[model samples]
Target: MFHRYLNKVAVVTGGSKGIGRGIVKVFVENGAKVVFCARGAAEGEALQAELNQSAAGSCSFLSCDVSQEEDIKRLIAHTVTLHGHIDCLVNNAGWHPPHKATDDTTADEFRDLLNLNLVSYFLASKYALPYLRQRHGNIINISSLVGTIGQKDAATYVATKGAILSMTKAMAVDESRYYVRVNSISPGNVMSPLWLDLAAQTGAAAEAIKAGESNQLMGRMGTEDECGLAALYLASEATFCTGVDLLLSGGAELNYGFKSQICS
Candidate 1:
């Protein structure tokens, strides 16, 4: 127990599973009352129950479709109702669509994803800003390495993430006067359920994951647990940091040649 964020009021989006799940768990364990939302009521309720059972700081879950502005409004309202003030907001609800050639991707599909992956963050931020301003709290946006370096066939997703990083900086600057810090975390290959599912879709899940790990400088893909800690750091410890993207890539972006027996 790191009780760094004890008695804090935090909101997490898409917190039923994967990196969102990790963030919620870590925050609850560290004594932050968390109000998290997801689309899956079953998973959300189960997690709520689990967190309430043993957590030092309890959590509640709301069934929310974050892309909807009404849902985002209700979510922030519900959190304020429960906790009185907002101290942290983790924008973690975005999704990546399946790989498709840029030419094959329909404009409508791109717009739909853009709404989910980008506009939803905007709505959440807009709705939550007043409460956050009152508390001088912080926001952590979960972005990705693909947004910085680009990935194949994920133009729309990458674009959304890039926009998030840009928006984070803009918000940080705008909110500096109010002491509401904003930052982004760009994680590379955080192995979540979604990552495993994608791997399984490609071929043998275990082998696919291994192949992905080999590309990392550490020769292992990051875990959602690691991502959670980074979020916790931003939310709790990095008081001086704002308008920056913490690159959680396990050194994968280093300009070093790939490891090979001969090269080594």
Candidate 2:
């Protein structure tokens, strides 16, 4: 029902599935000519075909590993070549490694995750900022509730997310001179394939999945679709908003007591 994105050109990373997939679907439905990337060509291509089949807007998928500078450059260049300009950039590609004590994680491992989760955002922004400035476009970084409140046994993950939140603010100020808006979305717990994979890895997928609902005060985890709508708002509307970390925590960020204890 949102018509704000008609003919807009957007670039989303990790668009094959889960939160990224939801964002792609919503943007295309709203009328964006979206170019989204995933490391795997099969899934990305499949999604592109599917979305282009029925969506009001068009979709094109490119194979990319956001961690690599070359790939990031290629993505932006290819998008501009096809769309002529970028109206929005959604940095949604990232992975959450299994939780481990800081002392248990290695320097190399930490750096690797940082390259994918943190550095990629910076690189993408750097490469697209000029075009974005021209269009007065926006950037939406997909942060997490942990970035705001912190999470145990996830020092590196939390650190990267915290950096993302901070970088969003810093970049917003720097980019504002050109009228480019930058912001972030800190999701609490969206029940996506990533969460399901983690639960399965714990060998208690059913129980752990059920417990996730209770972790939120609402007795349910947030959905990818809900996260999608939030991104849509920031991307299409929210003209006056910038440098803000919008929390989509389903009240988890505000609630205290057992819900807080169990969730965190």
Candidate 3:
């Protein structure tokens, strides 16, 4: 019912999997040509091939490390050269290191987390503004519920997400004069491949998933597509909305016991 993006060109960072991939799928299904970038060449190529075969939406994958300025510039240049103009930008690429307290986190790890989670968004927006300004496009940043309510043992992640919220607000106000809308979507726990990767690292995937599900009043973690829909709404139909943070946390932020939601 909401295929309003037909013929538009979009750029989605970290679109090879997880929430990013879900957003790409929705945009493509809605008739948008997508240029999605990820560091994984194999997954990127596979997704591109699948989209081409499905005839859902024309798509291409470019390898990019969003933390790097040169790579982000290259990504934007490539997309502009390929698609001519960008109608939307989705900053969905991010990383969450294992739960670690501030005291336990090394200086380097904290910096690395910020670089990946926060700096990437800034870099992407910096390079994408020219094209976005030309089209009066929109930017949708994928934030997190943790940004609103702090999570225990996730100080670095929470800090970065909080910064993202601030950045979205500041940028929205700064870009409104140009008719470009900027916003953010903060999603709660969602089941995605990232969980599997987390499991492989921490050896607590099954237990973690079970605990994550029970924390929500819905007794379930949200789906990636749910988050995607939130992003699509802000990036497309919400023309009157800017500097808004759409929280898709499924009531997880509501008042409750001060306890670890990750291991209910």
Candidate 4:
């Protein structure tokens, strides 16, 4: 176990599974005390027990629905109470709904996505900034590659992610005075449970998976561990980085036209 984050405290949202879980594990393995939350108590508690037993750092879990403002507020308060200060706030909670065309999407659906994907980040940052400023800590927002590069029939999801990138830059500018850095990660296609579930929704999971793999220049999907390592870099090592959108696309956006069949 590394001691880079030996005495730090980090709070990760939606940390029971997928990318959030990966981030939590990375932080704990690096020796940072972590307070992670998820709506499912079973998974959250199980992860807490498993990590505390095997990881170099300690971890605790809480039941939280990031869609609600009260839950975010409570989460921040509880973390400060337990750890006295927050060294990092990782906003990793959010959903990517099934593809839907603009004509089929409704106002309520858009608002709901905004509340879950965008507003929650804002609320968490707002509540955690005071403690973060005190510790000169940073905020790592989990955005998506599709936010910059458009996706098919996923306007709402894309909108939220794009907004997150913009918001991260604005927050960085405003929070610079406090010495609190703010940055974001835009992952292209990571092989997580959430990604698989979305792929299955297409009715041809295997084909969708293949296409996803082909979309990246590496001819494969990224792993949760990769995302975790990127977050670790931003939080611990990239001292000069702020308002930067670190793209984890595996060269997916390099050359236009069509994916190189030769490489595949």
**How well does each candidate superpose onto the true structure, as a TM-score?**
0.95, 0.96, 0.94, 0.96
Candidate 4, 200-260: lDDT as tens digits: 9999999999999998889999888888889999999999999999999998888875534
- Prediction 2 global C-alpha lDDT: 0.92
| lDDT (tens digit, per residue) of candidate 2 on 90-161 | 999998998788889999999999999999999999999999999999999998999988887889999999
Error in Å for residue 66 of model 4: 0.8
Model 1, C-alpha of 115: deviation from truth (Å): 0.4
Q: Which 10 consecutive residues of model 2 have the lowest summed lDDT?
A: 255-264
Clashing pairs in 3: none
**Regions more than 4 Å wrong, model 2:** 258-264
Per-residue lDDT of candidate 3, residues 17-97 (tens digit): 989988888888777899999998999989888887775468899999998889999999999999899989999999988
Candidates in descending lDDT order: 4, 2, 1, 3
Alpha-carbon RMSD, candidate 3: 2.6
lDDT of each: 0.91, 0.92, 0.88, 0.93
* Model 3 weakest 10-residue run by lDDT: 255-264
What lDDT is obtained when candidate 1 is compared to the true structure? 0.91
Candidate 4 RMSD to the correct structure:
3.2
